[model samples]
Target: MDDNLIFAVIGAGNTGQAMAGYLKLKGFAVRLYDRSEWRFKSLRKHSMRLSDEIVSSQKIDLLTTNLNEAVHGANFIIVSTSTTAHIEIAKRLSEILTNDQTILLHPGRTGGALIFKKILRENRPDLKITIGEFESSIFTTRVSATGSTVHYYGIKNGVHFSTLPAVDVRKIFQILKIYFLKLRPIRMCSTLL
Candidate 1:
């Protein structure tokens, strides 16, 4: 129910649509982005219909293939793309991301945050941003073959998340709790080689 937070979902797959629709359902402004325009051909008027556990038709604020347009002014950049795309996306994001923007990987898979953080540093060392990742996606969702509908499965509980610097966990957690009540903060160990 946060009225001020604007989210940019970076992907148009099942999870991305679910996250965007769910966030919009909760009364937040959301923009959906994808690299492929073909994926969006079936969507009508930039609206997504969610079925199953949660049912709602949400109109995304913006839908585009332009990464810069999607990232601009977004408070939270939610990366729902495949793990394999993380590196390249991180590289592109480093070019346009501004200070104080937070990036959250829906499911980092393995060492996703670390790799992304490293790439951002290498690409834009002075960029100040908080980057974090979940052990897995929060929602279990599936998009229909036509790409117009998303089957909303129940949210998974006990999802662990942590930020790169580990200093802003409390602040980020406060904002996240409104959306995900069951999220847990885990300390990212820097010493682990």
Candidate 2:
């Protein structure tokens, strides 16, 4: 794994927190952001903890309430926010993201990738976008917060990803494999859903 890889997870809810925790355990520098001040404050009180299987004391960098600060320069941006905010967030990111950056959507459902593609095409078509699925939310095993400690129950395997043009599948696979050792790439036939 590349120690230089930086991951920013937006949403800081269960899924976001879990991703940040797991990546941190894997030795990646992770930043977490959420719109909820309450959750942010809660996390602040108790730093996140990874499952027992992995050993690490790395704390996640919290970028609460500031979307741009969380995402602007990240090599990999994982959107774990609710589906309702997906389009709006993607639209905003289209203006700031560069072609080399990747956006991975967790638990993508009902045309989520299509929606992002639509907004990006209409706005910054030149920018590159990649979408993926992480089986389900990363914290599925078990997660509970008390004071400043967020505890996790388990971690799973295999994250699937695909690039917008499909031709860049290899590149996407290469980047994702660094953070997720078990990533599987699937090629899509069309850009439209």
* Tens-place lDDT digits, model 1, residues 18-116: 888899898998988999998788774447888999888888888899999999999999999999999899999999999999999998858888888
Give each model a TM-score: 0.95, 0.84
**Please, what is the whole-model Cα lDDT of each candidate in the order they appear?**
0.88, 0.71
| Residue ranges of candidate 1 with Cα displaced over 4 Å | none
TM-score of 1: 0.95
**170, model 1: CA deviation in Å?**
1.4
Residue pairs with colliding backbones in model 1 are: none
Residue-level lDDT of model 2, residues 1-193, one tens digit each, is: 4578888898777777777878877777788877777776656665665555554455676556787888877888888888899888888888778777777787664567777878888999677666554445545534454424445655556555565666777877776676666667777667354
Clashing pairs in 2: 45-148, 46-148, 46-149, 47-148
> For candidate 2, which ten residues in a row score worst on lDDT?
141-150
Residue runs of model 2 more than 4 Å from their true location after superposition:
52-56, 133-135, 145-151, 157-159, 191-193
